[model samples]
Each structure stands twice: as C-alpha cells, then as structure tokens.
Target: MLDLAKLASQIPGISQHFQREMTASRQRLERAQVLIRQTHAKQQDLIELHEQWRDRLIFSTATPVEPLDTRVPITPAPYSHSVFATDGSQISPSHHEIAYCYLINIGRVMLHYGQNLHPLLDSVPEVYYKSEDIYVAKQWGIRVEEWMGYRRTVLESEMLAEMACGWVNPPGPHREPNLALVDGSLVYWFLETLPHDARDRLLPPMQAAWSQLQAAKIPMIGYISASRSLEALNFFRLNACPHPTPNCIVNCSDLLDAQMPCQVVSPLRDVTLWAYLLEPGQRGPLWRSHARILNSYEECHRVYFCYVHVGTEIARVEMPAWVAEDSTLLDQALSLMLAQVYKGYGYPISLSEAHNYAVVKAADRVRFFALLEQEMLKAGLRNVGTSYKEARKRGSIA
Candidate 1:
C-alpha cells in the first residue's frame, strides 16, 4: 500500500536534493584525495602528530602500520584450506508473547576447499526464560532485547572458539590451512555506555573466548561489508587540522559555524576513500584501532583492520594484533578471504551460508510461539494468554 503516484510526484525534489548532495560529496572527495597525497609525503610528521594528540581526541581513531597510500595486491590463496564461520540470530522478547523469554540461534559452517570431505552446516539454538537471563540489571532500565543482543555476541564468539579449537586439533591426520571468521566488528564499543558491573560481566567471557582462539594459533577475522567507518578519514583529518596546538574541543570551537579544515574529508568514509585508491583484489594498509574498549582487552587481543577491495564492494576486515603482526598468517588470511569472496560472488561463502542457517523467518517466529504455548498448556499452565494488541494483530477486522 505505498502511494506510488504521490512518491512519483516528489521524485523531482528528491532528485534535486540528491544532485546537490552528490556535487558537494564529489568536491569533498577530491579535496580528501589531495590531502591524502599531501600527507603521504609527510607521513613521518603526521605519525608524530598522531602520537602527540593521541590523548586529547574524544573519538576512536586508527594508527597506520604502513604508508597511508599503500595498496597490496592480493596474495595467492593456498591450494587447500578450511574456513569456519559463525553467525547468530535472535528472537526479541515481546510484551504480547505468552511468556517472557528470548532465543538465540547460532548458525555455524565449516567448509573445506580442495578436499573431498563434506561441509558441515549446523545451528545451535538456546532459549532463556529465567528472570536472571532476561535481565542484566533491569533496574537500570536495560531491556530484555538489549541484554539478549550482548548474550548472542558472547554465544557467537564461544561457538567460533569451539570450532577453531577443534580445527587446531582434528581427530584425523588431515589438516588444511584454516581461519575462523565472524560477521561484525570485534570491538565492543557499545559496552562503553554500560555500567561497570555490566562491562565486567560481558568483557571477561568474550576475552576468554578470544584467548581460546589465540591459544589455538588460529587467525580469526571480523568482516564488515559496505563499511562506513570513519577511523581512517578521521586520522587524516587530525593530520589536516590547521591549529598549531591540537585541542579538538577548544581549537575547533570558533570554527563550529564554518567549515573546519578537517571537515574537507568529512564527506567520505574509509571504504569509499580507499575504493578510489585500490584496484579490485587489492587491500589497503593495516591500521591499529584505538577504540577505548581495548583498554579492557589484553594487549594481544587489541583489534586491527584494513580495507579490502573485492570486485563487487569494499569490505573492512579486522583481526587481533597477533594475527596482524605475523606477516605469514596475515597474508594467508587475506588470500583465503579473497578466494572466499570470489566464490561467493562478492561476499564470503562461508559467512553467507552461516547467515542462511541463522536467519529467523516470520513463519519460524509464529511456529516458535505456538510451540511455546502448547508446551505451557501441556504443563498445566492455564493462565497463558496474549495481549489484546497481539490478538488484534492476528485477527484484523477490516
């Protein structure tokens, strides 16, 4: 029931607005490219400037491990390799449901290339209905869905760790070069907004999972497609800052009404900026993320990332400091990832298959509630009922 005619009528104005924005964006992109080229020649000074202003900046930034403009061609993938990927889906608790509970389903995949062994496609589903399970300090106004999200993250990491550990010590004498892949950023930046108690609860378990992967000597990667991260651009902006004394708050206060010198790069993200510089199957330089959450992580578990240009899209690939520091392992990871992307026709095949297993469809949700209600009734709980709003939704009387 979208009003297509009305939407069509507004297309002219929308097109006009889009044109103006695109024109502005193009100008900013040109200026940013110029700034990047200029800074590349003075890379040492920019690095010094970053080190000097590292403390005063409020936002997360990146430290370049190589020249800012470095573009590495894709390394050749190994003849044989195994990829373990894990993704998760959840059912958010609804007030209209017969019970106050949520479920997390982790879809895991193990794929071996250049081998006759079959791939493993599986899912692990767990339900949480206990009062403690649904509430991570409910008194602080934390919703069940929010708590479940963190729980799912923990569960996904644990599952990935289990797969990685298993890969490290397989039952048979056959083993291929392998890596563990997850579908999002490893940094728990959102944890900064939570209380200390919540942080203590979540961080330790996640770190423990990471420790397991590290102990297994597995290269784990966090892949993000169509990434909008500003870490790289922000780093260049910090270098582009014209103030002699760099104080993000005070030095830029006067320029609030006008465009600041650093704002020249504001229109582009790290991915788009690199797309112009990198050819297909190439990767930009690695960067160390200085997200504040890393303070809670061990030095070995600190996150590093790079932009990879696949034929269809630019992706942000993240890994632990240890993986990035090891040149051999890093090259293996990037090559295997590129091969997977080519197989998937733009995305990683293992991650894509894992997502297929994790996704919870509308029919599945309805069936889940029905089964829950049936079980409750079988247990002699006669008071189970849905909210009036839910009832109306199920049977609309138009």
Candidate 2:
C-alpha cells in the first residue's frame, strides 16, 4: 500500500515550490501588462510589431493578416445555423495485458439551431496490427509507434477530414451554411517535431483531409480552451527589446535578461492578451499562425486563428485561410461557436457529445478480451494470459 502519511507531509514542501513559481510568474505577467499598455491603440506600434514578426522568419511568428483588424467588435451570429463537431479516442497496444493491437475510434455530432433531429450521430472505428504500422524506428532503435503520441495526432486530423469529405463537392439544398468544429488545433503541430522521414510519411493524409473539407465549402475550426500559446505576446517581446535586429533570437535570450523592459507580460498568452480587450461574444482578429508546417499547405489552406471570449473563458479557434477569407462563412461560424459554448454550459455541446460517443471505458476493454478469449477457446486454442505480475496480483500463489 502507498504511504499516505508520508505523502501528506510532503504537501507543505510542494506548496512552497508552487508559491515561489507563482511569484516569478507574476513578475513576468506584470511586465507583459506594461508592454501592452505602452503599445495599445498605437498604429505605429502595430506596424513595428508586424515588421519584427515578418523579419524573424527563422522562428514561428504572427503577422497581421488584415491591415489592422485586431480590435474588431463582436458580431452576433445569424438566428439559425447548423454546426458539426468531431472528437476521438483510442486504445493503444500494450504488451503488459492486451494483444499487440491498437484501435482508433471517432465520434461526430451535428446540431441545428433550436431544433432536435430524431437522431444525430456518427462513429467509425479501426484496428491496426500490421508490424510496420505498429512500430517506428528511431535513431536509437525501434519502439512502439505510440511512444510520443505523434501517430494519434495524425489520426485525429485524418479522421476529421475523412468525416467531412462527403460535403466537399457542393452545397445541397438540404444543407444549411454549416460550421465544423474539432477539439484541437487545425494543423498537426506535432508533425514538425518528428524526424523528416516520419513527418513525410504522416503529412499526406492530413493534407488530403483538409483539402476535402475546404473543397466542401465548410468552415472548420479547431478549438482550444484555456490555451497558453503566446503568439501575440511573443510579438510584444520582440518589440520590447532595446536593440532590434533581423536576428533577435541570436542574442535576445541573454539580452532579455539584462535589458528586460517587458517583464510585466513576459509569459502572457494570446487568450489572456485578448481577454482584457474583448467583451463576451467578441473575437480577436484573425492572425496567421507561425506554425512552419502550414507552409506546405496549398495557398488557400494555410492556418489562421482568433481568440473568442466564450463568457466563461477565452478560447483559441483555428481555421484555414479559405474559411477566414470568406466573410459569410466566418460570421456564421463565430455565431454558432458562441451559441454552442452557451448550450454546453461553457463548452461546445457537439464536441462534448462526440467525446462521449468515442470514449472507451475500462469495462469495455475487459469485455472485448473476454469475448476474444471465448472465441479462441471454441476454436481449440489456449486462453490468452495476462503478464506474470498481473497473474500474481490475481491470487496465483503457484
């Protein structure tokens, strides 16, 4: 059994560490606030910020997508519209208990404003066991493909895109101007971290899916709640530097320490920056994401993002440039997003339903194995065994 008493004693020490970290974080937060105060409402400051972002192409940075639209007021959505949201869950292969297999399942829900369909749901599940699909070879050696969760991210994009494919051709009379929502970033942000060969292998499917969604004329969004991304704050950091150059990264780390004029908002996130500026139902202006992987996308499919104040929290919403550029689709998407948030009691109802649809409970996994074992026994094969340690825990004294 665990040592509950000892764990309790360690609480004070943990609390001490947390307090120190908060003190440091607060200082940076203050600096960030000061930076914003100096630059807010200044046209020249925005221009300077833009130039710094564009100049530093070495690292990811955001530039103003519109002349100066960051302060656009919130606009109410149409009275009626349709929304679709998708989410997924997975069961990974484990040598400890289960067979060498993995499963990915997706769930989707569609909602029409002020109306309930008799039924509104979809699901897809796939299992994988092929050797090549189950493992990846790294510089050190081969390991299960699930190690860093790279594959799952690809699967998410692939699933969402695939599910949205049918709508790609043209809008039918039956279809309403619709908004598609996913519970994460529009881009496979992790792909950039993978080795080139691995990245190359995973890129095609995601691209194809996005292409289909774009072609369908659907404005799809990736929603992240309480996000910590600092795209806008990073621009402030660049502007705060006393000595500005094309390559601020080269010496900025050290420079920021000595001439740290921008400590007030040092660690500020984009949502936090926008939070102080936006009213409920308002959204930040669309800014192109600095994610380098987006460069590989077709011109129309490049990723853009905005911060939406959903009453309870600020959320980051990402979409392809094609969606962002379309005024009619963009407004409807924002309106529906806001409505979903309210319906969900501070979350997106369709996404929450999709999550519920795809979740795999532990009892479900046990039943799966039980059924498998029963079939194996009927076929004259021996029962599958748990690991020796697991067996011992289950009363196997022998």
Candidate 3:
C-alpha cells in the first residue's frame, strides 16, 4: 500500500495518450466524409453537362447543313385496282430471325425461298481445321468452304426477290397493277444482306420490278407497325418530349423520365393533341375510328401501337395508323370486323374484365402471325396462295 498516489499519476499519463489517439481518428473520419461529399457534388455537375451535349446532337431544327437532292419525278402515271401484299421473314446465319410482311397491291403473287447452306458439323474436331500438319492449300480450301455457306444464304434471298419480280412483269389476265404493301420500311436491308454476287444477280430483277410497278402507277408504301423494339419510337419520344419544342441537349434518359409508363399519350401538349387519344381503362377493339382513314388513304403509310384488351388477355397491337379522325360508325364497323375475325380464336383475356390492355411479350410471333393471317383473309385478300403441299415444301427449305 506504499506510494499509491504516485502509481495513480502514472496511470493518468497513459490514459491521456489513449484519448489523443481517439481524437486523431475522429478528425481523419471527418476529413474523409468531407471529401466524399465534394466528389458526389462534382459527379452530379458532370451528369448535367453531358445531358446538355446529347440533346443537341439528336434534335436540330435548322435545315440540314448538308446538300440534298430536291428533284421530283415530272411524268405522272395512271393507277390500277388489284392490290397485292407481300411478307418476308428470314433466319440469319447466326440463327437470329426477323420477319416483315407487307401488301403489294399492283403485282401478281410471287413466292421466293432460300436458305443458308453451311454445314455445321459438330463431330469434326477443332484440331483438324487448325492443325499445323495441314497443307496451306487445304487450309485455304477450308476457309473457302466456310465462306461459301454465307454466300449460299445470300443467294437464296436474291433468288426469291427475282422470283417476285418475274411474277410482276407482263400482267396476268384479270389482274392489273395497283399497289404493293410491304410490311416494313423501304430501307433495302433485305438487299444489303445478300453477297455481292447474289446482289448482282438480284439487283436487275429488283430494278425491273420497281419499273414495272412504277409503270403501272402502283404506289409502293412500306408500313412499319408499332414496334416496341424499334429505336424510332425511342427517338420520337425523345424528340417529342413534354416541352412544346424539344431542346437540343436532351437525350433518352430525359425523355424516359418525362414519359408515363403504359400511357400512349405523352405529356407534350402539342403531341397529345395530334396523336390518338387513349382513354384510361377503356377496353375495346384496338382499331377504333381508324379503319375508314386507312381505307381512304391510298398513298399514305403510317404506324401505331395500341393496347388491346381482348377479355382477360392483353395484347399490344403494333400496326399502321388507320384513323384520320373520330368516326363512331367506322369504329363500330371495324370492331365488328375484328370480332368476326377473332370469333373462334381464344383471346388471352376473360369476358368479365372491363379493360384488357395489350402488353409486349417476347416469343409472341406465332400468335401474331395467326391473327394477322386470319384478318387479311377476312379482308378478302389471299396471301401466298400455297396449298398444303407447297407450304410443306417451303417449310422444309426454311
């Protein structure tokens, strides 16, 4: 028990050292918090600046600074009565698939078919193709063989286009050139897919087909139905934002923010007036008040997406814009027509639901085609008049 006060003094010195260490740690943490806050503020500023630059790139109102041809065809042409429609679908070399169907009102019915011919032999060892022991000529032959497969597929599409052209020329009896409805944008992606040699083979026929159609005064209109996957819609939405005039610096992110999910009409006042009005919770035929407009417009091509509730099943119908104005009679008639076409077919929705809106779903192509085919047939058009045998043959090649 001797010198108790002296021992207590030593303990106080150690305790003071611990306190100082804790104080230093607290100061470092505060400094780090301050740095983080500064970084976050700078990041936000950069994001705003980037958005400004993007808007200007997409929507420039000024007349294109680049020179453009302004020439219009001088000679006017006559028209015909028989309308023809054509639809094309392709399975790519990489197994990707796309389909476009359209009506050509002017030409005779034509069918084209082709396929990629590359044999993907799974059993062949990779070493056989890559071996150093193989001769140079053998390696070259293997490469050539591989390329030939792509060339074959390209040739197939060309052949089909040519076949279509052949059907158009020297009009058949009881059939006159009228109009051609193609189910896509006329941007020539189909032609681009062919090989140079195949393109050369197909170009002349395509040119001849165009000339014949033009001579017949049959207007060719490419109509792209409402495509959710298309970038065009995204761009349109961005350009036509809630603002009366879109600012140049705005991009998709800004547009996305302005859009209301599942709402067809945008917040933009001007656009809201111009575009079709969709009533909330309204469940009826998708093409109300649009049929007469479609039938009356001979040369116009339009696109629209509608949320159609057929009972409990909701379907998003991407189709050509068919309505010019509100017409109750026409709407009723169109609804009747749709009901007739879809009578036996099972709709995804139930009878009790007030409104069933259409939603986009992956792998809905087969159902879409079936509905389209039924509608077209009901509209007094024979699409690809092939019998079971012929269809079977076509299916085999595909």
Q: lDDT by residue for model 1 over 1-398, one digit each (tens)? A: 79998789999999999999889888888988898888788877877887888777655678888998788998878888889999999988888999988899999999988888788899899998888778756966777778888888988999998887876664344557788899989888888788888878788888898888777667889999988899888877766777885677676665652276666767578887888889998999999998887888899989999999988989999999989999877998899998999999889999999999998998988899999999999999997989999999989977
Clashing pairs in 2: 29-264, 30-264, 31-263, 31-264, 31-265, 32-264, 32-265, 168-216
Segments of candidate 1 deviating more than 4 angstroms: 170-174, 254-259
Decoy 2 TM-score against native: 0.83
* lDDT scores in order: 0.85, 0.70, 0.33
Best-matching candidate per lDDT = 1
TM per prediction: 0.95, 0.83, 0.27
lDDT per residue (tens digit) for residues 1-398 in model 2: 68999799999999999999778866766666667666554646655666655554344566556533466555665665667777777776777664677777778776676445433577677677676667654552435644325555566667666655554345675566667788888777766666777767667776777677777777788888888887766655555655555454564545544355433454556776677778887777677776777766678878888888899999998888888999877886787787788989999998999899878787767776667667667788764766787657656564
Please count the clashing residue pairs in each candidate, in the order shown: 0, 8, 36
Model 2 lDDT, residue 391, Cα: 57
Residue 92 in candidate 1, Cα distance off native in Å: 1.1
- Stretches off by above 4 angstroms in model 2 are 1-34, 37-59, 67-69, 114-116, 136-142, 145-148, 165-170, 244-246, 253-264, 393-398
The TM-score leader among the candidates is 1
- Per-residue lDDT of model 3, residues 1-398, tens digit only: 47988788799889999899767655644543343234334543433443454334342111111111111111211122222333322211111211233111111132111222221111100111223322222433434333333233333233333433455556565443333434333333344444555445444554444444444433443333332232212233332244433443443334444343312322222112212223322222222112222222233223233333333233333322322122332233224322422432532111101011112122434454456567667887754343466456547954
